[model samples]
Target: MPSLATTETLIASSGRKSFRVVFEGFLHLMLLACAVVSIITTVGIVLVLLIESLQFFRDVSVWEFLTGTKWSPLLKPQHFGILPLFCGTFLVAAGSALVAIPIGLGTAIFLSEYASPIVRDIVKPLLEVLAGIPSVVFGYLAVVFVSPIIKSLFASADLFNAANACIVVGFMILPTIVSLSEDVLRSVPRSLREAAYALGATKLDVTIGVVVPAAMSGIMASFLLAIARAVGETMAVTLAAGATPRLTLNPLESIQTMTAYIVQVSQGDTPAGTLEYRTIFAVGLTLFIFTLLLNVIAQWILSRVREKYE
Candidate 1:
């Protein structure tokens, strides 16, 4: 029904629009490709760890690996006791959580409920800077600075020991917990706070009762993440927590975490393809599983809490 010129113009415009749509779709496909690549890479690493761990278990009985207390893979009689490492990891993680939970939660409360815009601007950057410090630097600080101070204080009090590493690790994870928890607290609906105020709730009461409960899921997830970081930390524990794998419950006694033991074996130059070399992968698998379980639990909690709030 249209003239040739009008029909040609309409065809050209439609072609251009179609081309634009295809180009946008291509960009989205590229983003999806990147996400797939990341997932594949993570899966590949887990597979490698699993395969090597299976080989180690083949040589060492599952019970021996799980129940053995001594972790001397290089010694004449190889022992692959995982309990000592578990003990060390739990001790450090527990200590870190004890130290971080209060301070981190307090900081979040201040940032979310108390701090003014100007104060927040200055404080948020400072908190981020603390997180930006390298783990190696934190390790050095624990070894050179914190350990000495802890030794002095504890020696004076007659309480000095390897527990100092736990304290230092706690401090190292403080920033992470604070930053994450604060973001979650800030995300709570303003209307909730307003409702509390209308009900004659004090600022403190509002923050503690309504806001904190609402953000509890995020706060808990942050705590779990902090524990994961503490468990996987290698250099800090290696330098500060001394490599003595004892089955003692005393935090003051020297202990070797799974990560620290891995670093020790790797740095000590265990020959490739030997049992000692394979032990690293085995230890790594344990650490990975521990952190993975924590992450899954954290995610589940967060999802349920978020759904309730939504």
Candidate 2:
């Protein structure tokens, strides 16, 4: 029913709208492509690990692998106990949490509640810089600097011990905890703070009692993710925690984590298709499963927390 110019204008508007729809569709498709790539890579790795671990289980009983007390795979009478590796990983993860939780939460509280704009600008960047340091550099520092100090302080400390690796890994993951926790704390509604202030609550009281509780889920998620990071760390553990898989809780004694064992087996002269080669894949599978579980738990906690707060 439109005239020629009016019809052209209408057609142009339709075309623009169509183009916008197509562009949005394309953007969504691109995001799907990224997700697909990630899924494919993860599936491929899992499949490889599963196959190799099946082969390993064929030679070594599942029960033995799971329950054995000795773990000397290269010795004449090979032992395949995973307990020592689990202990080492837990020690490092626990130690990392001990180090990261206090410092990280304190930093987060300071940043969100106490710090002025200028102080925050300086501190946040410095905290991020900690994350930027290479894992290998941290490994070197653990071996060269931390190990000696630990050995000096502890009478029973081994030159290469779980303590050194745990301390170093803790430092490495500190930034993650601090930054994520700070962001979560900062995201709390200003109205909440104002209400507390109106109630005559001190800044420290409001921050510790209200804000921290509100952000507890997010902080917990950060801690779990940091634990996952510590568990999966390889280089620092390999360099600082000697390649001795022994089931002990003594932090000063040398130990080998699952990741460190994988690194050891991979870097050695183990031929392809051999038991040692397969063992690395098995260990990798275990490490992958552990980290995946931690991440899933973290995500779950984060979602629940967000739902509550939002």
Candidate 3:
């Protein structure tokens, strides 16, 4: 009993609605495909690392790799101990943490608690620009500039030393910590600051006692993540810290990190299927494990902090 015009209108509306549903379904499929691709890529990387590392372990004992102090895989009478690499890696990471944590946290505090809006807007971008600079540039800077400074300060320091790498890697990870910590500090609720003020607390007391504690979870997470980055950093460490795989803790001495060794072996001279070639995967797996553990710890801290704050 509907008129023709009304029938046409209804059909047209239904068609449009159907088309919209189809479009939305297509979009959802596309998003799902992207997510699946990411998961597949990650799984593929893990599988490759595991398969290659298993082959590597077959030739070299895991105990030796874990507990051994020497690591001269490519040289004559090759050694496969990974402890020196481990020590060197952690040395840079720890030193970098010392440089980054205090400066980064202080910068975050100044930005979040003290800087004017205009100053923050100007300074934050400049700070983040450090993150965008290539690792190779930092390496060059370390070699050309930082290493010389260290040599001047300490006559015993080598041109390629752990301290040089540490300083450069610290600068490399600084932006991440500062940016993340600042965001976390800013996310603390305004009500907390107001409450502190009402109780006769100074701005410093409120910032230190209330806002920082409230955001400590996020700040700690950022620290872990930045340290992970420093641990995994390759080029700068490679250039600044030479290929010496010594287990000593002296910052003035040359050293080699796991990532640096991987880079050394991956330069196409080592034949495929050889023990040396396979070492890269083994080192890669170790680096992956280190970063994964850091991420897991960061996540646990973040969740616990969030629960407390919320």
Candidate 4:
């Protein structure tokens, strides 16, 4: 038989273990509830967009809004065409992607494969500092600095054209691309690199042939995230890209994006119930849907990549 003291110690240990289990269960429940809040909030926002957009559609045909060539909702014989907004938005987003992808990818590769720990520690912080800067600041810079430079380069370039806005938006998105991509690259198993090196592969070969392919999903995700950021950016695009909704292919000309339009109208005398004001919800819903599609693609890519590794 065990001694009384030993029996008592065992009972005390059991009691403590039970208490820990109970405490841990409570923590898990709390975390689960916290996670649910974000999902609920997202669903709630979508519902609001849908409800308000439906209210808009009651007055204007969905087909007309989607297919209209002009977007002058407030003018006489108003045309509620979304094409002009979509075109401008796409052009700017594409430009931002062009700027961010190559440069951000290169930065990620350098940080992941080539940089010393000290360099990474210094450079990483500096890159993240860009993200902390407000969108309005970037907008101001776009107008005062970027637009002037572009104008100097091409004498025909208009102030507050797509090019300046694109450049600024791209710069705004660079940090997201670099940070996420670097994390993805760094997540590649060290053993894979070791094995490649053991098989007589050079560092370049391993990085290019092995690490990059392995991290493709994450890199693509980063790119999509950057695209989404540029798509939704308001103040910068507003200040830089003039509010001229048009179907122009030239970067030298001015344009307005969906976000810029919504911002423009929301700041004015738009009372809540008017059809003019309801256009905001419609545009917002479109934007939400576009972003949702991008996120869906990202998730699909992530799943496929995860499957490859698994």
Best by TM-score: 3
**lDDT tens digits, residue span 1-310, model 1:** 9999999999999999999999999999999999999999999999999898898888999899988988788887777898988898888889878888899899989988899999999998998888878777777777677767776756642122357778778888999889999999999999999999999999989999999998888888888888888888877788778888777677766788888888888876788788789998998998888888888888887778762555
Compare the candidates by lDDT and give the number of the best one.
Answer: 3
What is the C-alpha local distance difference test score of candidate 4? 0.92
lDDT-wise, the better of 1 and 2 is: 2
Cα-based TM-score, every candidate: 0.89, 0.90, 0.97, 0.89
Write model 3 residue lDDT over 29-70, tens digit each, in one string.
Answer: 999999999999999999999999999999999998888878
Query: What Cα-based lDDT does every candidate model obtain?
Result: 0.84, 0.87, 0.94, 0.92
Clashes of each: 0, 0, 0, 0
Q: Best to worst by TM-score, what's the order?
A: 3, 2, 1, 4
Candidate 2, 284-304: lDDT as tens digits = 888888888878877887777
- Model 4 per-residue lDDT tens digits across residues 1-310: 9999999999999999999999999999999999999899999999999999999999899899999989999889899989999999999999988988999999999999999999999999999999999999999999999999999999998898999888888989999999999999999988889999999999999999999998888888899889989999999999999999998879989999999999989997878889999999999999888888988988987788752553
Error of 3 at 144 (Å): 0.5
Displacement of residue 212 (Cα, Å) in model 2 is: 0.4
Candidate 2 ranges beyond 4 A from true positions: 1-28, 296-307
Give the distance in Å from residue 191's predicted Cα in candidate 1 to where it truly belongs: 2.5
